[model samples]
Target: MGTKPPSPWDRHPSRSRPERAHRERPTDSNASMHADHKRELRLYGLNAVRAVFARRPEAIRKVYLNEARIPQLQALLKWCAVHRIGYRVVEDADLQKLAASSHHEGVVADVLREPAQSLLTWLQALSSDRHCALWLDGVGNPHNLGAILRSAAHFGVAAILLPQHSSLALSGAAARVAEGGAEAVPFVQLGESVEAIAQLHAAGFALAATVVAGGEDVFAAELPRRLVYVLGAEGEGMDRGLAADCDLRLSIVGSGAVESLNVASATAVLLAEWSRRGA
Candidate 1:
């Protein structure tokens, strides 16, 4: 007699169970590539997700919420329902998996990143005699960008500029760090330094390159009324050619034993001083 049909659970050498769809991981290389190309990010943490919803709900594509935080996110949920944005009540583990991080405080959002416009186009449209902008040169850290944006927003910076190939593209981490400045600031993409310098000069913006030395002390220098401050990466500062084209190369003076401050901290000090002078 044929043996009882092999049970579905029975481990057979020839038969294997189909993989569960839910088990797919975002950590896979292909998934990471997709995230980069799609300009999408999974933002985690209640405050982070809440801030996006409060500031730019339209940016939110979908939300995966932990069941436990339903009460806290009521307003957001109501808005999602009204907007027809899909949301799912998920287990904490599911959220952790989606974020690929343990820091998710019970919420995750898949949001659309607003594409940055060219500086030439955006600059022409924006008419201002006195405005401040930040240019990041090789400063690819998301957290630093977020911090700079926070300071920029507080001090009324009008725009953020980056090179055509800058790696510091907007990300959820930066947005979360900004605490909402991401919605307030307009990021502008610029071509090479020479072209950008000419364009800024034509637009009547004085460029200031921040450095550790060989420049006027930020406290003593007279900052420009319409200025663009360029900061560099963690170890390597601004390129020499870029500095040469800048109208002013300024240095922040500090008495700390450390050689230099981090980019974010330096940005706060500089923006504060500039704002204080009404520049």
Candidate 2:
């Protein structure tokens, strides 16, 4: 039997980082944040910035890199030129203040925001046969969000759904922890869980709520083709009403010592299992 040849990405594991492509600076501009670009957030670190450059160069509104990192960020600067995006070099100290931390790896960006679609519009848009997305009920820690997104992208989950009122938002810390997953995966804001779950049911997704008990072992059962894995914060777990709305409840089996897994950790496990089941 002949199988299709895999794409370069299929062969290249998602964990590997691409080395920076070098180039020279062209006409430059200041690194000031504009009111029009208020929607844009600053992203830092080499991998995170590189991911933005690779995935969507147009999103980058401005570039600020340390003078010493000029060579390392040449590709980004050249991109700024070709894209007519503005950029400027700053001392490493300026970078610290701009990034509000010393972990920026001498690079930051005012990445533009894409207009968000309504939840109905988003659900209408996903007409694919197999649909898998992560829904957060109350999870808001940026680092955990990033970790979940990293795993979600790695295993080919379609999107990350956050409630509109959730405290989660795109920040440099989250983007940096995602290590480019932020650029790779789609993020959507959902409204009330009841309303959203009803729409999901109409869309034909198997709503599986991850819980401490009253759920099946994902490793043992066959997952549906179209599934929505609803997970929540470590302590609170999913909202009771939301959990009741799910078609199935799923749990990860462990050694029975710890009461539960962190939301991000459990998400990675479930996503891995979802892929393993060939869903």
Q: Residues 1-279, candidate 1: write the lDDT tens digits.
A: 121222222333232332243545666876865665488767776766877787778878777777678778877777776776667767888878888777678888888777898988888888776788998888988888889888888888888898878867777677677877777788899998788889898888899999987779999998878888988888988888888888898998877578888999999998898899973
**How much lDDT does each candidate structure score?**
0.79, 0.78
Could you tell me the TM-score of candidate 1?
0.82
Candidate 2 lDDT score at position 32: 36
TM-score of each: 0.82, 0.82
Best by lDDT: 1
User: Candidate 1: lDDT of 38?
Assistant: 87
Question: Over 4 Å off in model 2, which ranges?
Answer: 1-35, 82-84
Error of 1 at 95 (Å): 2.0
For model 2, how big is the CA root-mean-square deviation?
11.0
